[model samples]
Target: MSTAHTALIVPPRLGEPLRVVPVEGPDSLKDLLGGDFESVARGDWHLYLNAEGTTGDLPANLRAAQLMHDCGLDLAGAARGPAVILGRDAKGKDTNIPEHLLRRAEELFGTPQAA
Candidate 1:
C-alpha cells in the first residue's frame, strides 16, 4: 500500500515533531509500538494507538489526541504513543483515515513537519 495509508502524528516521545508512517494493520502494529496494541473508537474512526503506552517508555500523545478532538472525533483522553487513525473500507477492512477527516486533522494540527 502507498504511504498515504499511514497515520499522521507526533513521535511516541514527547517534544518530537509530527510524522506520517505506514500502518498495515493491527498485526503490523506490534512492530511499530514494540508490543501489543489496542484500538480505541472515536466515532467512525478507530485509533490503533500503543496499548502499553500508559506504562511504556512513550509519553501521552496529547497533541495527536487534541488534533483528533478538534477534527470532531470524540477523543476521551490523552492518547498514548503514536496513534494510527483509520477507517473501515467497503469490505469492512481497516484502511487509511478518510480524506475529509484527514484534511480536518491537517487543518487543526497542521501537516507533518520536519523533525
Candidate 2:
C-alpha cells in the first residue's frame, strides 16, 4: 500500500515555540485517531474516557478545548457542558459578542483562534 502523510502544527508554550511534525503511514492514521477507535465506536460508554468520543474532527475539538482551558475556563466542564456560552438573542438566534470571542481568544493566547 502507498503511504500518505499529514502535517500537524503544535503550538508553542513559554519555552517552546511553534512545531510542525510530519506524520506518515499507519502511524499517521494512529495519530489521527488519537490511539482509539473501538472506544469511540461505543456511544457515551466512553464519555469520560479520553480519546473516546473523539474521531474525524477530534483534533480540532481537542485544540479548541485546550485553548479554552488556557483561557481561564474549565475545559472539562465545557466538554461536559458549554464551556464558552455562545450568545443568543430572545429569537434563539446567534448573536455576536461585542469584541468577538475570536479576538478575545487571540488576545489571550497570543495566537489566532482557529476559525
Candidate 3:
C-alpha cells in the first residue's frame, strides 16, 4: 500500500519573504489550491529539495518541470522563487513530509532530489 503523505511544491517564481509554515492535511492544501489537489499532484509532480543529513541515494534530474501549475501565478516570471518544500511530521504541530520519509516519496514521484 502506498502511504499517502502530502507535500507542497511552491512555484519557482514566487518572490522572497516566503516562510515555511505548518499546513494541515489535504484539506488545507485543497483550500490553498482552490479544491484542486489533482492539479497540484499532476502539475509536473516535482519535489526539488534534498532531505538533509541522509546517506541514501537521491534523484538526479538534470531538469524538472514547473513546481506549481495551479497556484495561479506566472511561473515563468517567478524564476527566483524557492525551488521546493516537502511535507513532514513537524513535531505533530502541522502537516509535514519528514526528511526520513523523503526517499519513499522520491521513489513514488520519481522526482530527482536536489543537490
Candidate 4:
C-alpha cells in the first residue's frame, strides 16, 4: 500500500475564497467526496473527484484548472466538484502532492478576490 499526503480542493461558491484543505488518509475520502468517488489523471498526479459531481451540485472547477495550469501541470479534462490530488513515487506508490504546488495554489487562491 502507498502512503501519501493528499490535498483537497473544493471549488468555491460565487465570490467566495477557494478551499484548499489537506486530506490525512483514505478514511477522510468518504467524508470529503461523499459516498462514491472517481479518479482522473492530470499530468503526474491523480485527481480524485466525487462520482456524482456531474449530476450533483458541483460546478465547474475553473479555479482549480487554472491553478494547475499556472503551475505548468497539464490537465487531462475539466474538473468538477471537490478534488483530491495525489502523486506516485518511484515504486509507483502514492506520495505527497508536491509541497510547492500546494503552496502556490494557496498563495494564488486561498483568499477572496476583489469584485
- Using TM-score as the measure, the top candidate is 1
lDDT of 3 at 14: 24
How do the candidates rank by TM-score, highest first?
Answer: 1, 4, 3, 2
Using all chains and alpha carbons, the TM-scores for the candidates as numbered come to 0.70, 0.29, 0.29, 0.64
Candidate 4: tens digits of C-alpha lDDT, residues 17-74? 6444556666666677665787755445666777887688677777666776775755
| Candidate 2 minimal-lDDT segment of 10 residues | 39-48
- Mark the regions of model 1 whose C-alpha exceeds 4 Å error after superposition: 1-4, 13-15, 71-78, 90-92, 113-115
Model 3: weakest 10-residue lDDT segment is 53-62
> Each candidate: what lDDT?
0.65, 0.33, 0.35, 0.62
User: Which pairs clash in the backbone of model 2?
Assistant: 78-83
Candidate 3: how large is its RMSD?
Answer: 14.1
Q: Clashing pairs in model 1?
A: none
Candidate 4, residue 42: CA error in Å?
4.0
Per residue, candidate 3 scores C-alpha lDDT tens digits across 47-81 of: 33322202223322221233233223333432332
* Candidate 3 TM-score, C-alpha based: 0.29
- Backbone N/Cα/C clashes per model: 0, 1, 7, 0
Task: Write down the RMSD of all candidates, one decimal each.
Answer: 3.5, 12.1, 14.1, 4.9
